[model samples]
Target: MLELEKVTAAYSGSKVLFGVDITANKGEITCLVGRNGVGKSTTMKAIMGLVSTPSGDIKLDGKSIFTLPTYSRAKAGIGYVPQGREIFPQLTVKENILLGMEANPGVKEIPQEIFETFPILKEFLERRGGDLSGGQQQQLAIARAVVSKPKVLILDEPTEGIQPSVIQEIGRVITRLKKDMAILMVEQYLEFVLEVSDRCYVMEKGRISMSGRTDELDKDRLQQLLSM
Candidate 1:
């Protein structure tokens, strides 16, 4: 589980998140959705310690992790799949996945579940990451993150640039993964978010403006917010 309380973050002295508060509970998917430049990605960055949070607290399982470095946060059970999918282009697929285990040094091999979640990865183990299609690369990114068995998985725009069929597969994978770990995602695709998320938070200008069970939120209103 992850919680951000009154989290105000900035990049180079310009604040982006303003008094943001959100929570991701174990065994559920929590989504943060909003238009561009509204600090959705910054919220994820703040949680990962990739951005500076001058004031506020980030907690994992009730303990504060605001002071932990990015690596420490990953080691502390946060597996992040950044917005761009950021996989190493030159590394072999297996090598890219193996990098995820840097946080869990004791794990000797890629867990079987990773292959189970993504059978395509098994066939592409020796292939260069850059050689894969965008969807395959996205699956590779998710595989790398989940291989570490993170308690809270942060996925930023998992559907971005992915094909429709791949998006459906990713949705299924996300639904399956939520049975084990807390899932927090930043997504602009409303249909995908509604299909997979248990709860939703609508952010506007760096603050959470609306939040509720996914089915309970006003779909038309959400569409309006995203359009603005």
Candidate 2:
């Protein structure tokens, strides 16, 4: 399991998260949902070790990773796809996916199953990442993370700005991924969250204000919280 225990973080001396606690268990998708700018991305960044967690600890499988750097955290089994689908635009599709292998040294070959999961990737192996459409880039970003075979996969707003058809594909991918690893996703699409996630944590002002199994969430109450 991946866990944040009273995790607090800041940027340039400005605090963003205060005692934020969440957990992602293996074989499940744990989603964090809220209105924009409620420290959702910050929590993801802190889990990825991209930002400093000054006051609390992050642990993976009961081991503290608070002191590890981003790359080290990746090596320790955390795969993160940040907002904006940050793939290497100049690199070929194959090269960009292969780059993720560097997190786990000695991994010289891209897994064959990855191509099976996203067939479009195999078709565009030689194409520059920049040439792909927005949805394609998002797929590539997710592929890059999964190719590493991390214990926990963290995604931030994966459905944002994506086409409806591609969003369905992404949901399918997320469901498949949870069978092998824990998923910590930040999502805004309510139906997508309820459809794919096992648990949902609603965040407000850098804290989890409400959380429960997706099936248990009150429909009208959920809509009210989301609109706040």
Candidate 3:
């Protein structure tokens, strides 16, 4: 399991997260949901070591990773697919996927499983990443992350600006990926959250205000929390 215990983070002099607590277990799909500027993405950055957490601990399995740098954290099995699908625009789809291998030493080639899961990638291996549509780029981003064979995958707002049909495909891909590793995603779309998340944590003003199994949350109550 990957866990953040009372994690507090700041940017320059402004605090964004306050004693935030959440966990993502292997084989489960956990989601961090909240409105804009509520610190969902900040929480993801904190886990990935892109931001400093001066007052809390981040653990992978049972070990503390608070002091590890971003590259070290990736070596520790934390794969991050940041928002906006930050693929190398000038690189081919195949090259972009290969870039993830830098995190995992001794990995020589893209895994056959990745191609099996995202067949479209096989068809467009030579295409530049920037040439693909938003949905295709999203798939390539995910494929890049999983190719590193991390124990946990952190995705930030993956469905944003994606088409409905592509959203469905990404949802299916996430479901399948959860069987082997933990998936901790920050998402804004409520319907997608309700469908894909096994557990949900609702963040408000830099803190977690509500969390529970997806089936346990009453839709009306959830709607109210999200709207607040």
List the global CA lDDT of all models. Answer: 0.94, 0.92, 0.92
Model 3 agreement with the true structure over 75-177: per-residue lDDT tens digits: 8888899999998999999999999988898689889989988899999999999999999999999999989888899999999999999999999999999
Model 3 weakest 10-residue run by lDDT: 219-228
Residue lDDT tens for model 1, 154-213: 999999999999999999998999988999999999999998999999999999999999
Error of 1 at 224 (Å): 1.2
lDDT of 2 by residue, 16-37 (tens): 9999989899999999999989
TM-scores of the candidates in the order shown: 0.98, 0.97, 0.97
Model 1 TM-score is 0.98
Q: What is the C-alpha RMSD of each candidate to the true structure, in Å?
A: 0.9, 1.0, 1.0
Model 1 scores worst on lDDT over the 10 consecutive residues at 101-110
Query: Which candidate gets the maximum lDDT versus the true structure?
Result: 1
Superior candidate under lDDT, 1 versus 2: 1
